[model samples]
Target: MIQDITTSIRTTVVLWLLTALIYPLLILVIGQGIFPAQANGSLIVNDQGQVIGSTLIGQAFSSEEYFWSRPSAVDYSIGEAAAPTGLSGATNLAPSNPDLLALTEERAEILQAANIAPTADLLYSSGSGLDPHISPASAIAQIDRIAAVRNLSLDDLQTLITQNTEGRFLGIFGEPAVNTVTLNLSLDQR
Candidate 1:
């Protein structure tokens, strides 16, 4: 019984050190060395060298001149940076729920007031509520409004949208979508 107890103690200590210390340290060093930008959080900077947002996270854009991301349930009242702003979750409201229908109608009216026909996606939030990307169709749906507000040509805006549109992963998995944050950043360049 003493021998068994001793062996268990020794094994536990060895495994704990390997998992809690050595393994994590090795991974951190390797990750930082191989992918510094990503390891550092994939931050995006503006022309003045201010951190704007991260490529891996979504930020809210409400300006008519800017392309908008999916409606994030996360509150941005906490900070200037949009990433890591608030907890992400869904409405979880059913299709027939009055609240869901009311929210959709409200969103549609907002777009219509701007004279843009909101797409189906624009009416509903994404699953994560943190999705930075929107379907190309959704982006295209708002082009006219954005162009009007920004005083840019429709053709140029269309070209910009086309340029930012990302195909499905390996042309198979996931749907084709455009990162609205990145797209708006590019628009700022214009």
Candidate 2:
């Protein structure tokens, strides 16, 4: 019995050492070297060089002059930088779901108040609650409101949106999207 206990302890020590120290250290070094930006959380900085947020996560914006990001269910309460809980999902509530119906009505009311057209992206949240981009249609839906609020012409805002819109991964894997952080930063510059 003692011999078996001693052997188990030795195996545990070896496994723990490898898992808790050596393997993590090796992965960190490799990750830092190969994917520095992602390793650093894909942070976004401003002209003042202040770190605003990460390009990988979405933030809520309620104003009219800025382009809004997707609805984030995370709420950033536990900690803004913490890995969001899996519960932070887009309700997945169907159109007929009472909660979804209420939310859609509220969103539609907001769009009407802003004199803007509503899009599907604006009405729902993404699965991860951390999408950093909006569909081009969603962005375009808000152009009139943003333009009117910023006192900029619709044509100019459209140009800005066009410039900020990014194509798919190597033109195939993912859909095109506009980065809300970049778009809002550009608005601040203007």
Alpha carbon RMSD to native, model 2: 3.9
Per-candidate count of clashing residue pairs (backbone under 3 Å)? 0, 0
Summing lDDT over every window of 10 consecutive residues in candidate 2, give the lowest-scoring window. 76-85
What's the true lDDT of residue 66 in model 2? 86
Q: In model 1, which range of ten residues has the least summed lDDT?
A: 74-83
Please, what are the lDDT tens digits per residue for candidate 1 over residues 48-112?
89998877777878887888777765532236554454566778999999998888899889878
- The per-residue C-alpha lDDT of model 2 at residue 152 equals 93
Model 2 Cα lDDT, one tens digit per residue, 1-190: 9999999999999999999999999999998999989999899987789998877777778887788887666653236555453335556667678987887788888877877677777777788777778899988889878887899998888888888888999989888999897888788888
What's the distance in Å from true for residue 121, model 1? 2.1
State the number of backbone clashes in model 1. 0
